[model samples]
Target: MTYESSASAFRHLLEARRSIRSFLPTRVPDSMIASVLQDAQCAPSNCNTQPWHVHVVSGSSRDRLSQALLAAEAAGRMSLDFSFSANDVHGIYGERLREQGAAYYQALGISREALAERRAASLRNLEFFGAPHAAFLFMPVFGDAVRVAGDIGMYGQTFLLSLAAHGLGGVPQTVLGMYADTIREELGVDPSLKLLFGISFGYPDATSAAAAYRIEKVPFEDSVVFHN
Candidate 1:
């Protein structure tokens, strides 16, 4: 591809990529998954430590994990390796978070005052939003784990982008990390690896409410201050 074409394609991919909350039951081909994983391997990391360990669950295993997650959630069992709470953020960050949640709930046609409905909607994350596959991302603790987290984020973006390029979609679920102990035990992951987050992926359900909604980014001026 020429410079202009390459730049256009790259920009298109970046702009087209977004979180897909609901997916169809059809599973993606294993070869396609392999291709996306291969492309994602090019993601850059801090000092190239390459600390991400991803386990992709599908078919019966995926359904079984969903059951286990539901049981753990019902019993209030949350085994988090890192602290995370959106409400803890203040100012613009908190406002943005709230805005996203409102948009999502609105799309689902669930009123903010409907606590039970909202809870049920949120619980969909445990079922991987009905996607046929889920990928749990884990990392070995290195130092404070801050740097490792950043590295994994890059890896995740790359993986998501690759999925988009292949006509697939995915959503990253932090809620899944809350059941880290359950996930590790079910997947037989090494004890040393700490859960970060997970990605639910497959063909997006275009007829679903989530497919019609998106959380727009804030203005460029609000995010960047020119130093030059």
Candidate 2:
């Protein structure tokens, strides 16, 4: 746990992980998912309450969920229970958002004016974007929100890194919140818990157009603040 070694490990993981949008048809083994969940459980929480519950979907259940989401999205039957928003974008935040969108659409060959096509592409977000494994994460209502949120962030990082280590990839999604009602009913989620987010995991399809997008990270100095 020396500083240098930990930094090296962190850098290596940073280089290895990517937001994978296209996945191969291969199924993710339950054991592997379980192990990732175990890694996620190492995330810190208030009094070690953990406060997170996850529902995993695959096989026919995954397919059915995808279909339900797509149908709802198509019919405009979606509603958002919560959302993350930037009320007023400024400087690097706005720039980063635009740049990422440009890069992604360029890779997919999707023109901005192609409204229907863009809508369809966006609906992919609601469908776990076709990844073989879809996991929905929730937080219990009684827990401290800030602590629970931090726990979720830690679990997410661990889960994504675990997938990267296994030659797999994942995309954590917020759009899934749009179909939360349907998702809750379909998955039999408890009323006391709230949907935190959804993550799609599987072997990435390297040749896919969406997979070709090269997401760039700002240089460390540009984003970091150093003390004298």
Candidate 3:
């Protein structure tokens, strides 16, 4: 692909992708998700090791997973395997995080003082946010973390873009990591392979409150740096 065309295609993709929160009960074809996963495998890796393993859940599996997650959360047995820390919260990225966090809670009618409400809201993450499909991406430690992370990023982008291309929508969820131990045990992933993140996929539910809650992205110039 030529540089111009490649840039144009990427631009289209950016405009097309959305962080879909509400999902339709209308089922998405398994083959479609499968094909997207196939494309996800196109991600580059160090030494072609391709260190991503995914587990897909839907139908009964999805329901069971949701039940397990709710149970774990209710029992206060949820372990924080990977979670965001507010250690350094004075930088640009920190500001961005705060802005989004405030916006999301406001959209959900959660208040600043409602810690229990926020915790309950967070538990929804393990429910795959009510989407029909939940996909977990894992990376096994084989020595080099940087290279594997790069590969994971590529795969994640490919998976999300492929879903958008197929007229489906999803949200890449890091909150799933909050209950990573429960999920890991439930999924029966090998001890070697670690959970990197997750994505919830399905047709967008236009009527849901979350569907209406949206945010605009920063302009391209503001986000990008140019050097010539």
Candidate 2 lDDT, tens digit per residue, 1-228?
Answer: 999999998889878899899888799888888888887778777778877788989999999999888888778887555566644667879888888878888889999998888877887786677788988888765535766776777778888888887778999887786678888888998766778788899999998999778887778898799999
**Tens-digit per-residue lDDT, 1-228, candidate 1:** 899999999999988889999999999999999999998889899888888999999999999999999999999999999989886999988998889999999999999899999999999999999999999999999889999999999999999999999999999989999999999999999999999999999999999988889888877898788987
Error of 1 at 107 (Å): 0.7
lDDT of 3: 0.81
Candidate 1 ranges beyond 4 A from true positions: none
lDDT at position 183, candidate 3:
81
- Pairwise TM-score winner, candidates 1 and 3: 1
Residue 184 C-alpha lDDT in model 1: 99
RMSD of 3: 2.6
> Ranking by TM-score, best first?
1, 2, 3
Question: What TM-score against the true fold does each predicted structure earn?
Answer: 0.97, 0.89, 0.86
- Report the Cα RMSD per candidate: 1.0, 2.3, 2.6
**How would you encode candidate 3's per-residue C-alpha lDDT over 1-228 as one tens digit per residue?**
999999999889877888887788777887888888888888777789888888998999889988988888779885654446675667887888888878888888889999999987777687777799989888876655667867887888889998988888989887676677778888897767767778999998877767767677777798899999
Model 1 scores a TM of 0.97
